[model samples]
Target: MSMSFGKSLAGSVLALAAASAAQADVPQVATDIAPVHGLVARVMDGLGEPALVVQPGASPHSYSMRPSEARALEQSDAVFWIGAELEPWLEESIDTLASDALVVELLGVDGITTLEFREGATFEAHDHEHGDEPHADHDHDHASEEHAAHDHADETAHDDHDHADEASHEGEKHDGHDHGDEEHDHEGEDHAGHDHAGHSHEGVDPHAWLDPENAKTWLDVIAEDLAELDPENAETYRANATAGREEIDAAMADVETMLSTADDVSFVVFHDAYHYFENRFGISAAGAISLSDATDPSPARVEEVRDTIRDLGVACVFAEPQFNQDLVATVSDGTDVQAAVIDPLGFELEMGPDFYPELIRSIGDSIASCTSSS
Candidate 1:
């Protein structure tokens, strides 16, 4: 009896050691934003959790990394981000800190659909084709060079601001039409650098995660990357990703059903960040108050948006949680337009595999509730 008990105890110890070894073998992954972190969390469900670089309620456009976040990057086995277009601030940090880590730029991923930046405060209807191939102008290599050029241009523009200001005043008095053209030219020249806040909006819109299809595509990419690092769990990673894709599809279908009640309802967003979600669901915003979230719309642009609301009889103006609510209030003050809050970042949601789908559903709910009432 004593001999049998000793053998059983030895078997239990061996099993525990093997389990601990497998756990230790899991890779340390890091992601830039909540949505990406949620997706990676889904893919790495059983293996490990990826560290989130940009925390909730913080704007990615102008975020400073905490020491803990920097350390997370330093210790990461792999780091994933949307690329310099979305987070130029992170580019240098990643190069400096996570030099040994495998970096995956999601914007440069193959089979992703990218949309060009729509100019001006109000957007015209876009008829641009969505293709599997990345746009030539937005090729990863070209984008990096363009980003570098924008940096140099920003310095030059800063130095020549006074000269440009004088030129503007002189041109304004000469002819209103010529002045308008000159102003447009100046804005175009600086658009990629700083005019629309700090974002590099010269080429593709970097909010691709808003599109469920892109999210699905990214799941496979995440799985493949994780598999490459830990081949022993390749099947598990791929399976988890496949499961994540199905969850997104199911959530998308539910969202479609929820939004069906508000098909004819017109709306405007705080910024032009929802094109991917809009285009995916066959709905479009009448106009955006700002070109991007980080930009503050000029008075003229705000007036134009007010005109849009009055003319289109827009049902709702969606405000973001991270932005000032006063802007939405100003836009909706005189009109019967219902002001509703929509969060693109899922700030309030608990971060996990389910967060992405919940974020999409919440937006749908916010829009549907307000528009249906209107």
Candidate 2:
């Protein structure tokens, strides 16, 4: 009996040693968004899966970190996020919780092309044949108060003459003094918050993954970072990243072919999150209902978007799965425009190696569906 017990203990010790050795090379990684996790998962296909911070069906723009998510960040070996511009809320939380982890800001990665949120960027008006006539000229500069007033007058000449001015004052007041305690707390909350000077909302467009070229760039970065962390799996990571790049390139071609079949299509999304996708595929949207999801668009802003749909002869208005569709329906109610759903976040899609391509391709399909029929 004593000999048998000694042999069993030796066997258990050997198994534990083997398990620890196997896991020694693996790093516990985490990502900020589902689409980003999809990319990282593809890169670490054979290696391991990374934790996702922003779960499916949640908007990264307005996500509040759950305690579980916070604990996950605390325990992660590496945390990858786009940047402070894409997720200002995560900036402070990450800094506070994961100060020791290898934090990567993908938007700041070299070779990734970042576009600015134009003061007044709109989709180019194209006919069914894809012939691009000059769309509305963006000559009205919003930065200059005089030009703003003049353009507001010119655009709203029909309705109550003082409506625009009154609304402008109301908006200014809301921004300055009437934002309420919740909004004020969000703005002033301190947990190693972001330096908003350069990365303000008006500066960078954070939808880089929508472009396949940028995905390829980010994949290379991911592989490189993982390689630095786990040299044993360096070759495997590089191979997976290369394969992922090829897959993304193929998906980009597929999107181009799919989107080309449709013409005379213009859309307005829930928010301005699809510009990277739009600019990549030459597919244009008329405008967005709001700038960000954190705050609701004012009534005047919604009315302005309604006017855009009418003036641009927009064919379809697309809302996001993560937001209320009633707003889209309201915008299209009396018009000939069709209301549809386009999800940029892959909120409803199964997330994995194929998620990035599916997200991009689905947007194309959604646009084609509405535009081709219209």
Candidate 3:
């Protein structure tokens, strides 16, 4: 029988439970992608380094579990994923995983304001061609803030995800989406802590962690979960999360500053992964060539983006380091869209094994310099 993601996850928890001090290697953990892995590594604080199923320069949008990655998850103490919608591949099977292994959906981590995953929100879509649904939380806030001015759009305007604004003009606007995917089931919690089994809401964007602040939440949750899993090293997990958050806090400021006042407020890109990045600093791009990680741009999308770029006079159309370069070159080439590479995964940077911080900062610097060079 084929092992499911949940079964693999359960086996991972067991393996991790058995990882006593006698073990030579670090505690075992598995992440869905480089960013989450980097955050996990930070929270783990060298006690056990986590591995990512998705390597750097890879698109998390279309990523699937490979045998090697699945086996790795089986050996993990905990498995960290972005969220159900972000990584739908892990959804059904993740439940089957052993209860011992911790499954973290970072975007659902508390204390962060998540955005709506709706049509014409920020970039385009990759995985969801079916339709744009509303998260109960985001949808509420959007409606509450229905009268909110364009202030939300100031910095993260295009990426702020105040779909409520879009809602009004959209025949109906809504706000305050809180999928809270990371809410700890706290054992005694409702449904007998079954909420910890998975996510609560849907259509809330999972890439919120791509924002440095959101990533800090992931680190915090990782540390908290680690402490829960290994009370002996709870302090260690806390310390690591604290350090990681500090780094992230500082890095977020830098990203904010880098994006605060762009030389060219309007730019373009191949993919829409930079919503967090763009929102942090208030920079607005014309639009993205690619909508989601799993999907490609259609001919209509291409023309629409082309027209937008031309109208907006965007200088740069950033391309991701891991995706197929052909689309970017094919459509963006020769146009005013100067294609540049952006590393959302922190793919190539070897900032120690602690590359997550370095990854965000590096990307910040890249965006900062992109238009300013002119």
Q: Which candidate number would show the highest lDDT if scored against the true structure?
A: 1
TM-scores for every candidate against the unseen true structure: 0.80, 0.75, 0.69
Clashing pairs in 2: none
lDDT of 2 by residue, 77-105 (tens): 77788766666567767777887777777
Model 1 regions lying over 4 Å from their true place: 1-6, 125-200
C-alpha lDDT (0 to 100) for residue 270 of candidate 3: 66
Write the residue-wise lDDT of candidate 3 on 1-374 in tens digits.
55698899999888877775424434577778777777887777667677767655545554445677777777766777776556554544454542345566566555565655423312334224533232222222211221212111112222222211110011111122222221212232223211112222234656676667677666666676666667778888889888988988787777777766574566776666666665555555556665544244445566676776666666776777655567666666557656678777776786334677788878778777777753
Which is better, 2 or 3, measured by lDDT? 2
Least lDDT summed over 10 consecutive residues: which range in candidate 1? 160-169
- TM-score, candidate number 2: 0.75
User: Residue 336 in model 1: shift from native, Å?
Assistant: 1.2
Off by over 4 Å in 3: 1-27, 96-99, 118-202, 351-353
Tell me how far candidate 1 lies from the true structure as C-alpha RMSD in angstroms: 9.9
Count clashing pairs, candidate 2: 0
lDDT of 1 by residue, 45-142 (tens): 97789999988876565455778899999998888887766676677788788877778887777667777666565554333333223242222332
